[model samples]
Target: MKLVRKTIFWLHLGIGLLAGVLVLMMSVTGVLMAFERQIVEKADGFHITATGNPLGPEAHLDGLRTAKQPPSSLGFERDATRPVVYQFGKEKAVFSDPYTGKSLGNGNTAVRGFFKFILSWHRWLGREGASQATGKAIIGIGNLMFLFLLVTGVFLWFPKRWTRSGVKAITLLQKRLKGRARDWNWHNVFGFWAAIPLLVIVISGTVISQPWATTLVFHLAGETPPVQGERKKPAPFTLPESLAGLDAAFATVKSSNPDWQSIQLQLPFAKTATFIVADSHRGRPDLRRTITVDLATSGIVKSEGFDDLGPGRQTRTWIRWLHTGEAGGLPGQTIAGLAATASAVLVWTGFALSFRRFFKKRRAAA
Candidate 1:
């Protein structure tokens, strides 16, 4: 039993040290991203009062199509006050009033840049192209290590005997401890409390980074994973004489869900394409309602609500919400943010204790 405990301790220490920097970066960036949407909204002055007399989707489509280079997609803002967003070829997007077809200009660049930087480092270690791919692979592997660390950390936190005193010693931080002892207590106490949320966050993160994990999720849910590029292609057809179908399709979805908070329309690139509408209510993105319309016929191809999704897909959506704490709204975000902050502390304390022990061993040898 003693040897087993020692082995687990060494394994925990080794893995933690190996993945410390990557985990630290992820935790710090996660803390920043926990409230990112709110910050960006504030920075961009996003609030707009809706005018009941808004124009139809066709006008917005025309306005975007007539631009210097036509946008590949158009996102209709469900909020009557907000401008519809037109996304050009990757990375370029502009907002225009849905009622007037007038440009509202791009949003605050500085704010966008700030979030972009955070996201890049959070996912790709601030690398680009091939290096970014490599960084992502590293981060994914490190996340696995981090997940293992969480499990072993709890095991190491367990006291020799299960008693009221033993429980209190591990659960509460001792104020009187100094140096190494203080760091050890801080690491264990925080680890014990932060374990569950961090585990959820890490597992969700791994699911996102690994395709096999996603497949496993689907298998567990008793559903087959969707194959890539398997969407049935629409029969070849020409552009409609008038883009009235776009407006008609938008109305169909809006009339169905009158209380939808926002609806983003993705204009199809092919002559035979489907208009993909992403709907959400009350700022809860995890509860997205998707409606697909055939461009050729302007007919509703499919309308899927959150509840209508198969277990595999539904689990995927929930995993994303869990990772970002969007599932629980503001309170969820607060908990996820706090967990990330505690994780940073755990990394710091772990490093401090490891280094102190290392130096002490060397001193004793001398």
Candidate 2:
């Protein structure tokens, strides 16, 4: 039994040392992203007055079509104070007033850039193209190792005999301790308390990073995983002289859900493409709704709510919310942030201990 415990301890230490830097980068980025949505919204400075009645979706599209370069999509803000936004190409966006369809300059590029930079590092280690794929693979593997470290760390943190002193040593930090002893106590205590939430965060992250794990999630949920690249091709048709269909699709979705927090209308990529409307509920991404409309007929093709999702898709959605700590609102975000911060500390302390042990052994050999 003692030998088994020793093996687990050494395995934990070795894995921690190997993956510590990547884990630390991920942890720090996770901490930053905990409040990213809120921070970005505030930084965007997209405010408008609610005095005048807002124009209908069609009218807004008509206004946006007059831009020097037509936008590929339109975003409607549910908040009356916020202006409508038009997305051009992939990353550029323009803001406009909902009341009069008047231009309000560009969307918040600085905030968008900041978040994009952070997300690139968080998701792909700031790499691009083939390197990005390699980065994601590394992050996925590191997340699994991180989960393993958490489990082994808990085992290592268990009290030897369950005595009061032993329990305290594992559960509480001793403030009076200095240098290595302080770090040791802090690492153990923080790891013990943070094990559960950290487990959840890492598991969800792993599931998202690995395609096989995603399939496993669906299988466990009693549903068939969707096959990749199996979308039905749109029926061939002629392009309309105007974007009247886009407005009609938006109106259809908005009329059904009057309380929608925001709506994004994706323009047809091809003449046969369907117009897609994403109606997101305020602060509740899981509850966001989707609608598809035929490009030729301006008729509703399909509309889906959160409850309409299959078990597999629903589970994946919930996993995303859980991973980001948004499912539980502010308190959940706070917990996730603390867990990430603690994880960073754990990496730091683990390296410190390993180096100390290495030097001590070298001196002893000398």
**Per-residue lDDT of 65-135 in model 1, one digit per residue for the tens?**
43455566677665565667777655777877666667777877788788889999999889987798788
**Predicted model with the maximum lDDT:** 2
Clashes of each: 0, 0
Model 1: number of backbone collisions: 0
Model 2: lowest-lDDT 10 consecutive positions: 269-278
Cα lDDT, all candidates: 0.79, 0.80
The sequence of per-residue lDDT tens digits that candidate 2 reaches over residues 130-221 is 79889899899999999999999988887779899888987888989887888899899989888999999999999889989999999999
* lDDT accuracy of residue 225 in candidate 1: 97
Cα shift from native, residue 320, model 2 (Å): 1.7
